[model samples]
Target: MTAVPVFLYHAVSDNPPRWLAPFTVSPRTFVEHLNMIADSGLRVVPLRQLVTTLLGGPPLPPRSAVLTFDDGYADFASTVAPLLAGRGLPATLYVTTGALHASGTPSGRGPFPSAATLSWGQLRELDAAGFEIGGHTKTHPQLDTLPRTSVREEVGGCKREIEDALGHPVDSFAYPHGYSSRTVRTLVWETGWTSAAAVRGPSALSSNRDDPLRFARLMVRADTDRKRFELWAQGEGAPVAPFAEGLRTRGWRAYRRARAVTGHPYRALPTDEG
Candidate 1:
Protein backbone atom coordinates (compact mmCIF):
# COMPACT_ATOMS: atom_id res chain seq x y z
CA MET A 1 0.00 0.00 0.00
CA THR A 2 2.31 2.70 -1.20
CA ALA A 3 1.13 6.33 -1.01
CA VAL A 4 2.11 9.15 -3.36
CA PRO A 5 3.06 12.42 -1.69
CA VAL A 6 1.67 15.65 -3.20
CA PHE A 7 3.48 18.86 -2.36
CA LEU A 8 1.40 22.06 -2.09
CA TYR A 9 2.88 25.51 -2.60
CA HIS A 10 1.51 29.06 -2.74
CA ALA A 11 3.82 31.89 -3.91
CA VAL A 12 7.53 31.84 -4.73
CA SER A 13 9.08 35.25 -4.32
CA ASP A 14 12.18 36.77 -2.76
CA ASN A 15 10.08 39.18 -0.74
CA PRO A 16 6.66 37.81 0.06
CA PRO A 17 4.03 40.14 1.44
CA ARG A 18 3.94 40.43 5.21
CA TRP A 19 0.55 38.73 5.25
CA LEU A 20 1.71 35.77 3.17
CA ALA A 21 5.13 35.32 4.67
CA PRO A 22 4.48 31.99 6.29
CA PHE A 23 3.48 30.36 3.00
CA THR A 24 5.92 32.13 0.71
CA VAL A 25 9.05 30.28 -0.42
CA SER A 26 11.67 32.50 -1.98
CA PRO A 27 12.93 31.72 -5.49
CA ARG A 28 16.37 30.82 -4.19
CA THR A 29 14.95 28.39 -1.67
CA PHE A 30 12.56 27.06 -4.33
CA VAL A 31 15.47 26.40 -6.63
CA GLU A 32 17.34 24.65 -3.90
CA HIS A 33 14.26 22.59 -3.15
CA LEU A 34 13.91 21.67 -6.80
CA ASN A 35 17.55 20.70 -6.95
CA MET A 36 16.97 18.44 -4.00
CA ILE A 37 13.94 16.93 -5.69
CA ALA A 38 15.96 16.29 -8.83
CA ASP A 39 18.58 14.55 -6.75
CA SER A 40 16.07 12.66 -4.57
CA GLY A 41 15.25 9.90 -7.08
CA LEU A 42 11.50 10.55 -6.88
CA ARG A 43 9.53 10.87 -10.10
CA VAL A 44 7.49 14.09 -10.12
CA VAL A 45 4.24 13.70 -12.04
CA PRO A 46 1.36 16.05 -12.83
CA LEU A 47 -1.64 16.09 -10.49
CA ARG A 48 -3.78 14.55 -13.24
CA GLN A 49 -1.53 11.53 -13.55
CA LEU A 50 -1.62 10.91 -9.82
CA VAL A 51 -5.42 11.12 -9.74
CA THR A 52 -5.72 8.95 -12.83
CA THR A 53 -3.52 6.23 -11.43
CA LEU A 54 -5.26 6.41 -8.09
CA LEU A 55 -8.60 6.09 -9.86
CA GLY A 56 -7.42 2.84 -11.51
CA GLY A 57 -6.49 4.40 -14.83
CA PRO A 58 -2.99 2.97 -14.85
CA PRO A 59 -0.21 1.95 -12.55
CA LEU A 60 2.42 4.59 -11.81
CA PRO A 61 6.15 4.10 -11.78
CA PRO A 62 7.76 3.62 -8.39
CA ARG A 63 8.77 6.60 -6.25
CA SER A 64 6.13 8.77 -7.89
CA ALA A 65 4.94 12.14 -6.51
CA VAL A 66 2.95 15.21 -7.57
CA LEU A 67 3.58 18.99 -7.28
CA THR A 68 0.74 21.49 -7.08
CA PHE A 69 0.46 25.26 -6.62
CA ASP A 70 -2.61 26.85 -5.14
CA ASP A 71 -3.90 30.41 -5.71
CA GLY A 72 -2.86 31.61 -9.15
CA TYR A 73 -0.08 33.97 -8.19
CA ALA A 74 1.64 36.11 -10.80
CA ASP A 75 4.95 35.15 -9.25
CA PHE A 76 4.24 31.62 -10.46
CA ALA A 77 4.46 32.88 -14.02
CA SER A 78 7.21 35.42 -13.43
CA THR A 79 9.33 33.09 -11.32
CA VAL A 80 8.18 29.51 -10.78
CA ALA A 81 7.01 28.46 -14.25
CA PRO A 82 10.27 29.25 -15.99
CA LEU A 83 12.15 27.13 -13.50
CA LEU A 84 9.73 24.23 -13.90
CA ALA A 85 9.80 24.65 -17.67
CA GLY A 86 13.57 24.46 -17.59
CA ARG A 87 13.36 21.25 -15.59
CA GLY A 88 10.62 19.85 -17.86
CA LEU A 89 8.45 19.30 -14.81
CA PRO A 90 4.66 19.62 -14.95
CA ALA A 91 2.58 21.05 -12.07
CA THR A 92 -1.03 21.96 -11.40
CA LEU A 93 -2.04 25.58 -10.77
CA TYR A 94 -5.44 26.13 -9.16
CA VAL A 95 -6.83 29.54 -9.98
CA THR A 96 -9.33 31.73 -8.15
CA THR A 97 -11.38 33.30 -10.94
CA GLY A 98 -12.35 36.48 -9.15
CA ALA A 99 -8.82 37.46 -8.20
CA LEU A 100 -7.61 37.73 -11.78
CA HIS A 101 -9.72 40.87 -12.05
CA ALA A 102 -8.02 42.49 -9.08
CA SER A 103 -6.18 45.83 -9.39
CA GLY A 104 -2.72 44.20 -9.38
CA THR A 105 -1.99 45.37 -5.87
CA PRO A 106 0.66 43.62 -3.78
CA SER A 107 0.71 42.52 -0.12
CA GLY A 108 -2.82 42.28 1.20
CA ARG A 109 -4.99 39.87 3.19
CA GLY A 110 -7.30 39.19 0.27
CA PRO A 111 -7.61 35.91 -1.63
CA PHE A 112 -4.42 36.99 -3.34
CA PRO A 113 -2.21 40.02 -3.03
CA SER A 114 -3.24 42.62 -5.63
CA ALA A 115 -0.54 41.47 -8.04
CA ALA A 116 -0.72 37.81 -7.23
CA THR A 117 -3.38 36.58 -9.68
CA LEU A 118 -1.98 35.42 -12.99
CA SER A 119 -3.41 36.93 -16.13
CA TRP A 120 -5.58 34.86 -18.47
CA GLY A 121 -2.86 34.89 -21.10
CA GLN A 122 -0.31 33.49 -18.67
CA LEU A 123 -2.72 30.81 -17.54
CA ARG A 124 -3.28 29.79 -21.15
CA GLU A 125 0.45 29.67 -21.71
CA LEU A 126 0.79 27.42 -18.73
CA ASP A 127 -1.94 25.17 -20.13
CA ALA A 128 -0.19 25.15 -23.50
CA ALA A 129 3.01 24.17 -21.74
CA GLY A 130 1.26 21.02 -20.45
CA PHE A 131 0.59 22.32 -16.95
CA GLU A 132 -2.77 21.57 -15.38
CA ILE A 133 -5.14 24.54 -14.79
CA GLY A 134 -7.51 23.66 -12.01
CA GLY A 135 -10.23 25.63 -10.21
CA HIS A 136 -9.87 27.23 -6.78
CA THR A 137 -13.43 28.59 -6.84
CA LYS A 138 -14.60 32.03 -7.96
CA THR A 139 -13.55 33.94 -4.82
CA HIS A 140 -11.65 31.32 -2.79
CA PRO A 141 -14.40 30.75 -0.24
CA GLN A 142 -14.47 28.32 2.68
CA LEU A 143 -16.77 25.64 1.28
CA ASP A 144 -17.96 24.15 4.57
CA THR A 145 -19.65 27.34 5.68
CA LEU A 146 -21.50 28.04 2.46
CA PRO A 147 -24.84 26.66 1.39
CA ARG A 148 -24.82 23.79 -1.13
CA THR A 149 -25.95 26.09 -3.91
CA SER A 150 -23.25 28.63 -3.11
CA VAL A 151 -20.70 25.86 -2.94
CA ARG A 152 -21.82 24.65 -6.34
CA GLU A 153 -21.27 28.09 -7.81
CA GLU A 154 -17.87 28.33 -6.16
CA VAL A 155 -16.78 24.94 -7.43
CA GLY A 156 -18.74 24.51 -10.64
CA GLY A 157 -18.69 28.09 -11.79
CA CYS A 158 -14.94 28.32 -11.40
CA LYS A 159 -14.47 25.10 -13.35
CA ARG A 160 -16.66 26.46 -16.13
CA GLU A 161 -14.78 29.74 -16.12
CA ILE A 162 -11.37 28.10 -16.42
CA GLU A 163 -12.52 25.63 -19.05
CA ASP A 164 -14.05 28.45 -21.06
CA ALA A 165 -10.94 30.56 -20.78
CA LEU A 166 -8.54 27.74 -21.72
CA GLY A 167 -10.91 25.99 -24.16
CA HIS A 168 -10.26 22.75 -22.27
CA PRO A 169 -11.60 20.73 -19.40
CA VAL A 170 -10.65 21.72 -15.86
CA ASP A 171 -10.73 18.46 -13.96
CA SER A 172 -8.99 19.31 -10.75
CA PHE A 173 -10.23 21.40 -7.78
CA ALA A 174 -8.53 22.69 -4.63
CA TYR A 175 -10.32 24.00 -1.55
CA PRO A 176 -9.25 27.43 -0.37
CA HIS A 177 -7.09 27.14 2.75
CA GLY A 178 -7.34 23.34 2.50
CA TYR A 179 -10.73 23.50 4.23
CA SER A 180 -13.70 21.36 3.10
CA SER A 181 -16.64 19.32 4.32
CA ARG A 182 -18.24 16.07 3.17
CA THR A 183 -20.86 18.21 1.48
CA VAL A 184 -18.16 20.26 -0.08
CA ARG A 185 -16.42 17.10 -1.29
CA THR A 186 -19.65 15.81 -2.77
CA LEU A 187 -20.23 19.10 -4.57
CA VAL A 188 -16.73 18.94 -5.99
CA TRP A 189 -17.35 15.48 -7.40
CA GLU A 190 -20.79 16.43 -8.64
CA THR A 191 -19.40 19.47 -10.41
CA GLY A 192 -17.61 17.12 -12.84
CA TRP A 193 -14.18 17.58 -11.35
CA THR A 194 -12.25 14.32 -11.32
CA SER A 195 -10.44 15.17 -8.11
CA ALA A 196 -10.06 17.77 -5.36
CA ALA A 197 -7.22 18.65 -2.95
CA ALA A 198 -7.17 19.14 0.83
CA VAL A 199 -4.52 19.77 3.47
CA ARG A 200 -4.28 18.03 6.82
CA GLY A 201 -0.57 18.48 7.02
CA PRO A 202 1.45 15.24 7.02
CA SER A 203 -1.63 13.40 8.22
CA ALA A 204 -2.95 13.37 4.65
CA LEU A 205 -1.90 10.52 2.38
CA SER A 206 -2.85 9.66 -1.20
CA SER A 207 -2.98 5.88 -1.35
CA ASN A 208 -5.26 3.77 -3.53
CA ARG A 209 -7.60 3.49 -0.61
CA ASP A 210 -7.79 7.25 -0.12
CA ASP A 211 -10.59 9.43 -1.42
CA PRO A 212 -9.71 11.30 -4.58
CA LEU A 213 -11.90 14.27 -3.66
CA ARG A 214 -10.05 14.51 -0.37
CA PHE A 215 -6.53 13.98 -1.70
CA ALA A 216 -3.93 14.94 0.89
CA ARG A 217 -1.25 17.55 0.19
CA LEU A 218 1.82 18.46 2.28
CA MET A 219 2.48 22.17 2.66
CA VAL A 220 5.85 23.55 1.53
CA ARG A 221 6.36 26.82 3.35
CA ALA A 222 9.09 29.46 3.54
CA ASP A 223 10.67 27.85 6.59
CA THR A 224 11.07 24.40 4.98
CA ASP A 225 14.85 24.16 4.96
CA ARG A 226 16.70 21.67 2.82
CA LYS A 227 16.86 19.11 5.62
CA ARG A 228 13.12 19.38 6.42
CA PHE A 229 12.23 19.49 2.72
CA GLU A 230 14.18 16.35 2.07
CA LEU A 231 12.46 14.54 4.87
CA TRP A 232 9.03 15.65 3.58
CA ALA A 233 9.92 14.74 -0.01
CA GLN A 234 11.05 11.30 1.07
CA GLY A 235 7.89 10.74 3.17
CA GLU A 236 9.88 10.38 6.38
CA GLY A 237 8.61 13.17 8.65
CA ALA A 238 4.83 12.79 8.35
CA PRO A 239 4.20 11.85 11.93
CA VAL A 240 6.21 14.56 13.63
CA ALA A 241 6.22 17.48 11.20
CA PRO A 242 2.68 17.67 9.81
CA PHE A 243 1.13 16.34 13.00
CA ALA A 244 2.31 19.36 14.93
CA GLU A 245 0.82 21.72 12.37
CA GLY A 246 -2.20 19.53 11.80
CA LEU A 247 -3.21 20.03 15.42
CA ARG A 248 -3.57 23.75 14.75
CA THR A 249 -5.24 23.47 11.33
CA ARG A 250 -7.60 20.83 12.63
CA GLY A 251 -8.40 22.82 15.76
CA TRP A 252 -9.10 25.96 13.76
CA ARG A 253 -11.42 24.15 11.37
CA ALA A 254 -13.27 22.66 14.32
CA TYR A 255 -13.69 26.08 15.84
CA ARG A 256 -14.99 27.42 12.55
CA ARG A 257 -17.41 24.53 12.25
CA ALA A 258 -18.75 25.16 15.71
CA ARG A 259 -19.16 28.82 14.95
CA ALA A 260 -20.97 27.96 11.73
CA VAL A 261 -23.37 25.72 13.65
CA THR A 262 -23.99 28.42 16.21
CA GLY A 263 -24.76 30.94 13.45
CA HIS A 264 -21.99 33.15 14.71
CA PRO A 265 -20.73 33.60 11.13
CA TYR A 266 -17.08 33.00 10.48
CA ARG A 267 -15.33 34.67 7.59
CA ALA A 268 -16.79 33.57 4.29
CA LEU A 269 -13.25 32.67 3.30
CA PRO A 270 -9.81 32.58 4.87
CA THR A 271 -7.91 35.77 5.52
CA ASP A 272 -4.38 36.54 6.64
CA GLU A 273 -5.23 38.17 9.97
CA GLY A 274 -2.59 40.25 11.67
Candidate 2:
Protein backbone atom coordinates (compact mmCIF):
# COMPACT_ATOMS: atom_id res chain seq x y z
CA MET A 1 0.00 0.00 0.00
CA THR A 2 1.18 3.53 -0.77
CA ALA A 3 1.63 6.17 1.89
CA VAL A 4 -1.34 8.49 2.18
CA PRO A 5 -0.70 12.22 2.21
CA VAL A 6 -2.65 13.28 5.28
CA PHE A 7 -3.04 16.97 4.45
CA LEU A 8 -3.48 19.23 7.47
CA TYR A 9 -5.20 22.61 7.15
CA HIS A 10 -5.88 25.55 9.52
CA ALA A 11 -8.39 27.80 7.79
CA VAL A 12 -9.84 28.50 4.35
CA SER A 13 -10.45 32.08 3.27
CA ASP A 14 -9.27 34.88 1.01
CA ASN A 15 -9.28 37.41 3.81
CA PRO A 16 -6.20 39.54 4.35
CA PRO A 17 -3.19 37.90 5.99
CA ARG A 18 -5.37 34.79 6.33
CA TRP A 19 -6.05 35.54 10.02
CA LEU A 20 -3.73 32.75 11.18
CA ALA A 21 0.01 32.25 11.19
CA PRO A 22 -0.12 29.80 8.29
CA PHE A 23 -3.28 31.58 7.21
CA THR A 24 -6.30 30.05 5.46
CA VAL A 25 -6.49 28.93 1.88
CA SER A 26 -8.86 31.07 -0.12
CA PRO A 27 -11.96 29.26 -1.38
CA ARG A 28 -10.63 29.57 -4.93
CA THR A 29 -7.28 27.96 -4.18
CA PHE A 30 -8.94 25.41 -1.94
CA VAL A 31 -11.29 24.27 -4.68
CA GLU A 32 -8.44 24.31 -7.14
CA HIS A 33 -6.41 22.21 -4.76
CA LEU A 34 -9.23 19.74 -4.42
CA ASN A 35 -9.50 19.62 -8.17
CA MET A 36 -5.81 18.99 -8.32
CA ILE A 37 -6.22 16.09 -5.93
CA ALA A 38 -9.01 14.64 -8.03
CA ASP A 39 -7.04 15.12 -11.22
CA SER A 40 -4.06 13.40 -9.65
CA GLY A 41 -6.22 10.27 -9.15
CA LEU A 42 -5.99 10.29 -5.36
CA ARG A 43 -9.06 9.14 -3.43
CA VAL A 44 -9.85 10.88 -0.17
CA VAL A 45 -9.73 8.16 2.49
CA PRO A 46 -11.10 8.63 5.98
CA LEU A 47 -8.67 8.66 8.95
CA ARG A 48 -10.23 5.62 10.57
CA GLN A 49 -9.96 3.74 7.29
CA LEU A 50 -6.25 4.43 7.29
CA VAL A 51 -5.88 3.09 10.82
CA THR A 52 -8.05 0.09 10.10
CA THR A 53 -5.95 -0.59 7.04
CA LEU A 54 -2.92 -0.35 9.28
CA LEU A 55 -4.51 -2.86 11.62
CA GLY A 56 -5.30 -5.04 8.59
CA GLY A 57 -7.73 -3.13 6.41
CA PRO A 58 -7.48 -3.90 2.73
CA PRO A 59 -5.18 -2.07 0.36
CA LEU A 60 -6.37 1.36 -0.76
CA PRO A 61 -6.63 2.91 -4.19
CA PRO A 62 -3.34 3.85 -5.82
CA ARG A 63 -3.89 7.58 -5.19
CA SER A 64 -5.66 7.20 -1.87
CA ALA A 65 -5.16 9.90 0.79
CA VAL A 66 -6.28 10.73 4.30
CA LEU A 67 -7.70 14.28 4.56
CA THR A 68 -7.31 15.81 8.01
CA PHE A 69 -7.61 19.22 9.67
CA ASP A 70 -6.11 20.33 12.94
CA ASP A 71 -7.25 23.03 15.43
CA GLY A 72 -10.99 22.52 14.75
CA TYR A 73 -11.40 25.98 13.18
CA ALA A 74 -14.96 27.25 12.95
CA ASP A 75 -14.01 28.14 9.40
CA PHE A 76 -14.12 24.41 8.74
CA ALA A 77 -17.92 24.58 8.81
CA SER A 78 -18.07 28.09 7.44
CA THR A 79 -15.54 27.59 4.64
CA VAL A 80 -14.01 24.19 4.00
CA ALA A 81 -16.77 21.80 5.01
CA PRO A 82 -19.28 22.99 2.43
CA LEU A 83 -16.74 22.68 -0.35
CA LEU A 84 -15.81 19.19 0.75
CA ALA A 85 -19.43 18.16 0.92
CA GLY A 86 -20.01 19.57 -2.51
CA ARG A 87 -17.16 17.42 -3.80
CA GLY A 88 -18.33 14.30 -1.96
CA LEU A 89 -15.03 14.06 -0.06
CA PRO A 90 -14.55 12.85 3.50
CA ALA A 91 -12.41 14.70 6.07
CA THR A 92 -11.51 14.44 9.72
CA LEU A 93 -11.36 17.35 12.15
CA TYR A 94 -9.04 17.02 15.14
CA VAL A 95 -10.18 19.48 17.78
CA THR A 96 -9.02 20.94 21.07
CA THR A 97 -11.84 20.30 23.53
CA GLY A 98 -11.08 23.23 25.79
CA ALA A 99 -11.15 25.56 22.82
CA LEU A 100 -14.68 24.32 22.07
CA HIS A 101 -15.83 26.12 25.21
CA ALA A 102 -13.74 29.22 24.59
CA SER A 103 -15.57 32.36 23.52
CA GLY A 104 -12.60 34.66 23.56
CA THR A 105 -9.21 35.30 22.02
CA PRO A 106 -7.18 32.52 20.32
CA SER A 107 -3.67 32.08 21.64
CA GLY A 108 -0.32 31.17 19.97
CA ARG A 109 1.64 32.62 17.01
CA GLY A 110 -1.04 33.42 14.49
CA PRO A 111 -0.06 35.55 11.52
CA PHE A 112 -3.74 35.72 10.62
CA PRO A 113 -6.68 36.73 12.76
CA SER A 114 -7.47 33.95 15.19
CA ALA A 115 -10.93 32.60 14.47
CA ALA A 116 -13.22 30.88 16.93
CA THR A 117 -13.01 27.08 16.91
CA LEU A 118 -15.91 24.62 16.57
CA SER A 119 -18.31 24.15 19.46
CA TRP A 120 -19.37 20.74 20.76
CA GLY A 121 -22.80 21.09 19.17
CA GLN A 122 -21.12 21.95 15.88
CA LEU A 123 -18.86 18.92 16.26
CA ARG A 124 -21.91 16.72 16.75
CA GLU A 125 -23.26 18.03 13.49
CA LEU A 126 -19.93 17.33 11.83
CA ASP A 127 -20.11 13.77 13.12
CA ALA A 128 -23.60 13.48 11.75
CA ALA A 129 -22.33 14.95 8.50
CA GLY A 130 -19.78 12.07 8.19
CA PHE A 131 -16.68 13.80 9.51
CA GLU A 132 -14.44 12.04 12.05
CA ILE A 133 -13.86 14.00 15.24
CA GLY A 134 -10.48 13.39 16.84
CA GLY A 135 -8.53 14.86 19.73
CA HIS A 136 -5.91 17.60 19.51
CA THR A 137 -5.76 18.37 23.21
CA LYS A 138 -7.85 19.69 26.04
CA THR A 139 -6.52 23.26 25.87
CA HIS A 140 -4.08 23.27 22.94
CA PRO A 141 -1.15 23.18 25.35
CA GLN A 142 2.34 22.51 24.10
CA LEU A 143 2.35 18.90 25.26
CA ASP A 144 6.10 18.88 25.88
CA THR A 145 5.84 21.69 28.45
CA LEU A 146 3.26 19.83 30.50
CA PRO A 147 3.77 17.10 33.06
CA ARG A 148 2.82 13.52 32.21
CA THR A 149 -0.39 13.88 34.18
CA SER A 150 -1.21 17.06 32.33
CA VAL A 151 -0.39 15.34 29.07
CA ARG A 152 -2.92 12.64 29.88
CA GLU A 153 -5.43 15.31 30.74
CA GLU A 154 -4.76 17.10 27.49
CA VAL A 155 -4.80 13.95 25.40
CA GLY A 156 -7.34 11.83 27.23
CA GLY A 157 -9.67 14.61 28.31
CA CYS A 158 -10.23 15.83 24.77
CA LYS A 159 -11.21 12.36 23.58
CA ARG A 160 -13.55 11.91 26.52
CA GLU A 161 -15.14 15.29 25.96
CA ILE A 162 -15.68 14.68 22.26
CA GLU A 163 -17.13 11.24 22.97
CA ASP A 164 -19.35 12.56 25.71
CA ALA A 165 -20.67 15.44 23.65
CA LEU A 166 -21.05 13.58 20.37
CA GLY A 167 -21.93 10.13 21.71
CA HIS A 168 -19.09 8.60 19.72
CA PRO A 169 -15.62 7.46 20.71
CA VAL A 170 -12.74 9.59 19.41
CA ASP A 171 -9.93 7.12 18.83
CA SER A 172 -7.53 9.37 16.97
CA PHE A 173 -5.41 12.19 18.43
CA ALA A 174 -3.28 15.00 16.98
CA TYR A 175 -0.63 16.68 19.08
CA PRO A 176 -1.24 20.15 20.44
CA HIS A 177 1.09 22.75 18.90
CA GLY A 178 2.38 19.75 16.92
CA TYR A 179 4.47 19.01 20.00
CA SER A 180 5.01 15.48 21.29
CA SER A 181 7.74 13.48 22.99
CA ARG A 182 8.26 9.73 23.43
CA THR A 183 6.57 10.21 26.75
CA VAL A 184 3.71 11.98 25.07
CA ARG A 185 3.25 9.01 22.72
CA THR A 186 3.10 6.66 25.67
CA LEU A 187 0.71 8.99 27.40
CA VAL A 188 -1.56 8.94 24.37
CA TRP A 189 -1.64 5.15 24.33
CA GLU A 190 -2.10 5.09 28.07
CA THR A 191 -5.04 7.40 27.60
CA GLY A 192 -6.65 4.72 25.39
CA TRP A 193 -6.36 6.49 22.07
CA THR A 194 -6.02 4.20 19.06
CA SER A 195 -3.79 6.58 17.09
CA ALA A 196 -1.96 9.91 17.32
CA ALA A 197 -0.65 12.29 14.64
CA ALA A 198 2.33 14.64 14.18
CA VAL A 199 3.39 17.15 11.53
CA ARG A 200 5.66 14.65 9.76
CA GLY A 201 5.37 14.93 6.04
CA PRO A 202 4.15 12.22 3.59
CA SER A 203 2.52 9.15 5.10
CA ALA A 204 3.48 6.15 7.19
CA LEU A 205 1.08 3.77 5.43
CA SER A 206 3.01 3.95 2.15
CA SER A 207 5.57 1.58 3.62
CA ASN A 208 3.18 0.11 6.20
CA ARG A 209 4.88 1.07 9.44
CA ASP A 210 3.41 -0.47 12.63
CA ASP A 211 3.23 2.66 14.74
CA PRO A 212 -0.41 3.61 15.24
CA LEU A 213 0.17 6.41 17.75
CA ARG A 214 2.96 8.48 16.14
CA PHE A 215 1.67 9.01 12.59
CA ALA A 216 3.40 11.69 10.48
CA ARG A 217 1.54 14.33 8.48
CA LEU A 218 2.25 16.86 5.79
CA MET A 219 1.27 19.76 7.98
CA VAL A 220 -0.03 22.28 5.46
CA ARG A 221 0.83 25.63 6.97
CA ALA A 222 1.14 29.23 5.62
CA ASP A 223 4.18 28.49 3.45
CA THR A 224 2.74 25.46 1.63
CA ASP A 225 1.40 26.16 -1.87
CA ARG A 226 -0.56 24.15 -4.44
CA LYS A 227 2.29 22.66 -6.44
CA ARG A 228 4.14 21.90 -3.24
CA PHE A 229 1.06 20.20 -1.88
CA GLU A 230 0.87 18.02 -4.98
CA LEU A 231 4.48 17.02 -4.66
CA TRP A 232 3.98 16.32 -0.96
CA ALA A 233 0.78 14.31 -1.45
CA GLN A 234 2.66 12.17 -3.94
CA GLY A 235 5.17 11.23 -1.25
CA GLU A 236 7.83 13.66 -2.42
CA GLY A 237 9.00 16.63 -0.37
CA ALA A 238 11.34 17.42 2.47
CA PRO A 239 10.72 14.55 4.90
CA VAL A 240 8.90 16.45 7.65
CA ALA A 241 9.38 13.77 10.32
CA PRO A 242 12.93 14.87 11.07
CA PHE A 243 12.00 18.47 10.48
CA ALA A 244 9.41 18.24 13.26
CA GLU A 245 11.95 16.70 15.61
CA GLY A 246 14.59 19.26 14.69
CA LEU A 247 12.12 21.98 15.56
CA ARG A 248 13.39 21.55 19.09
CA THR A 249 16.75 23.12 18.24
CA ARG A 250 15.04 25.24 15.60
CA GLY A 251 11.94 26.11 17.71
CA TRP A 252 13.77 27.76 20.56
CA ARG A 253 12.41 31.07 19.34
CA ALA A 254 9.14 30.92 21.25
CA TYR A 255 10.36 28.44 23.86
CA ARG A 256 13.40 30.57 24.53
CA ARG A 257 11.43 33.78 24.30
CA ALA A 258 9.19 32.44 27.04
CA ARG A 259 12.21 31.46 29.15
CA ALA A 260 13.90 34.81 28.57
CA VAL A 261 10.77 36.55 29.71
CA THR A 262 11.25 34.83 33.07
CA GLY A 263 15.09 34.62 33.01
CA HIS A 264 15.60 30.85 32.93
CA PRO A 265 17.01 28.08 30.71
CA TYR A 266 15.19 25.32 28.79
CA ARG A 267 15.53 22.58 31.30
CA ALA A 268 12.73 20.24 30.26
CA LEU A 269 12.75 20.89 26.55
CA PRO A 270 13.83 17.79 24.61
CA THR A 271 15.06 17.11 21.09
CA ASP A 272 12.49 14.34 20.54
CA GLU A 273 9.47 16.19 19.16
CA GLY A 274 7.55 13.05 17.95
Q: Using alpha carbons, what is the TM-score of model 2? A: 0.80
In model 2, state the lDDT of residue 204: 27
lDDT by residue for model 1 (42-128), tens: 788877777887587877776788889988888988899899999998899988887764344333334665445677778888889
Off by over 4 Å in 2: 16-21, 102-114, 201-207, 240-274
lDDT of every model, 2 decimals:
0.76, 0.67
Which TM-score value belongs to model 1?
0.87
Clashes of each: 3, 8
RMSD of 2: 5.0
RMSD of each: 4.0, 5.0
Error of 2 at 130 (Å): 0.7
What's the TM-score of each model vs. the native?
0.87, 0.80
Q: Model 1, which residues run further than 4 Å from truth?
A: 102-110, 202-205, 239-254, 260-274
Residue 88, candidate 1: alpha-carbon lDDT:
90
